[model samples]
Target: MATPDFVLDLRAKIGTDPLWLCGVTAVVVKGEQVLMVKRADNGAWTPVTGIVDPGEHPATAAIRETLEEAGIVAQVSRLARVGVTGMVTYDNGDQTQYVDLTWRLEWRSGHPHPADGENTEARWFDARSLPSLSDDMARRVGAALLPHGEAEF
Candidate 1:
């Protein structure tokens, strides 16, 4: 993933100290499959995600990230879930806490591919047979798949 310019500026002042950021995760769905990306940084599979740029709407960021990371144009079908979560320290010592908004998205056009260097692979998985994911990610996806409406926390 390309480090946001804000993150780079912060890192210059604080080195590897933890930073609080806002992000969006897109659960881009087509029929019964969900789009997923295998991250280049750690090879872990997850929904399309990216830091929300300053002043950008979470829904807009979700769609933009889906296109940027997976080569698919999407629209936020619904806001699935929203909450503050995370305090992760990467192997490189960069730490971040992300307040994430996860959205259920509908694919509009284009095939899935790893368009950005951040993702090593991007594909659609049968909703019932998804690959192993971190508990947090599983919960996010599950929230998007819920039979009811949006969730807030």
Candidate 2:
């Protein structure tokens, strides 16, 4: 007899395996430039993103993280993507398995400064002037920033 795979069953099994946290990132664009940060820990330049608090929604997390990490305020335009990311470990023994809900945010107001305890150097670069980044980071900044991302809110 032939059998079909059950998506819900597979999801349930996967969900039970680890601690998951919600995170957000901004594809913050101002004119022809985008904002990125070099993480103090790893020195990898990435968009401003972080984990959502216990009672916070994904959109709220995105806005809060933008202000916290980059010292800039942004209007969350649309949810670019919602997918689970692999467990990323830090040198400090802090490991996170993330269920990232990233969004396309527009530069609304304020200046850039490194705040909150996450990043060190924050700078604006022309989209083309962006530095080499991991593949996951690159995709989240590229195709995900369009208005077509889910409006799940």
Candidate 3:
């Protein structure tokens, strides 16, 4: 896995965890709704995410994952949030700590469906009607909508 953009930047600032350079997540929002995919792996609702591939840009991977998982295309609107957490990586054998870069994506256009291997179900839900989600996904959504954060590419 490669370090997502914001995570790498955050690691520079925080300076301790060598593993801060790790995965990324995306919180895609549309209208008064947000997009969520039921992950095929865990059978749980989560934000669109993937391990950043080597030599690929984080933003590109985020956009790609959004398309592939949720069957929707969106524009990256902001660096909604960055989280420091533990990840049990597939490429590595440890639950080493990670800095997750979560982007807020604005709807562009696309019909919603489960588009790839990662998702089983993909749909938009009313902001108020959001289903039970992982704590990390829920936290990312809250942070993306907060007034204090700036939209960063």
Candidate 4:
């Protein structure tokens, strides 16, 4: 994943110290299919995810990430989950944790592809037959699949 410029600036001052950041996971659905991407960094298959830019709305971030990472245009249906992630130690020795906002999105246009280099592959899979995902990613998907209502915390 590409680190944002603001994060890079902060890293310059804080070194490897843990930083709290906002992020988004976009679970884009079209009928019974869901969009997923294979990460270029770790090869983990997951819903479209990205760091929220400064001052951007989380819902907008979800939509933006979907297009930037997966070549899919989507609109947020609802915020499905809001939670803090476990500490992540990046390959470059940077440590961080994200307050992740997962949103269920409705696919609007475009075919899925790894539009940005952050992912190796992007495609749709049957909601009931998705590829294996990490527990955290699975939880995000699960939250998005629930009946529309208040976001899970």
lDDT (Cα atoms) of all candidates against the true structure: 0.90, 0.73, 0.73, 0.94
lDDT of 2 by residue, 1-153 (tens): 011134234435664344456677777888778889888767899998776666778788788878878898888778776667898654534355877776888888888877765777888888887899889888788755465745432
Which prediction has the highest TM-score against the true structure? 4
Return the TM-score for each candidate structure: 0.94, 0.79, 0.76, 0.98
Q: List the residue pairs that clash in candidate 2.
A: none
Off by over 4 Å in 4: none
Candidate number of the best lDDT: 4
| Clashing residue pairs in candidate 3 (N, C-alpha, C atoms within 3 angstroms) | none
RMSD of each: 1.3, 9.7, 6.5, 0.8
Candidate 2 accuracy as lDDT: 0.73
Cα lDDT tens digits for candidate 3, 43-133: 8887788767667777877898888777888987778776777554544332356567888788899987988666788888888888897
Clashing pairs in 1: none
Candidate 4 per-residue lDDT over residues 1-153, each given as its tens digit: 788999999999999999999999999999999999999999989999999999999999999999999999898899999989999999889999999999999999999999989999999999999999989899999999875889999
Could you arrange the candidates by TM-score from highest to lowest?
Answer: 4, 1, 2, 3
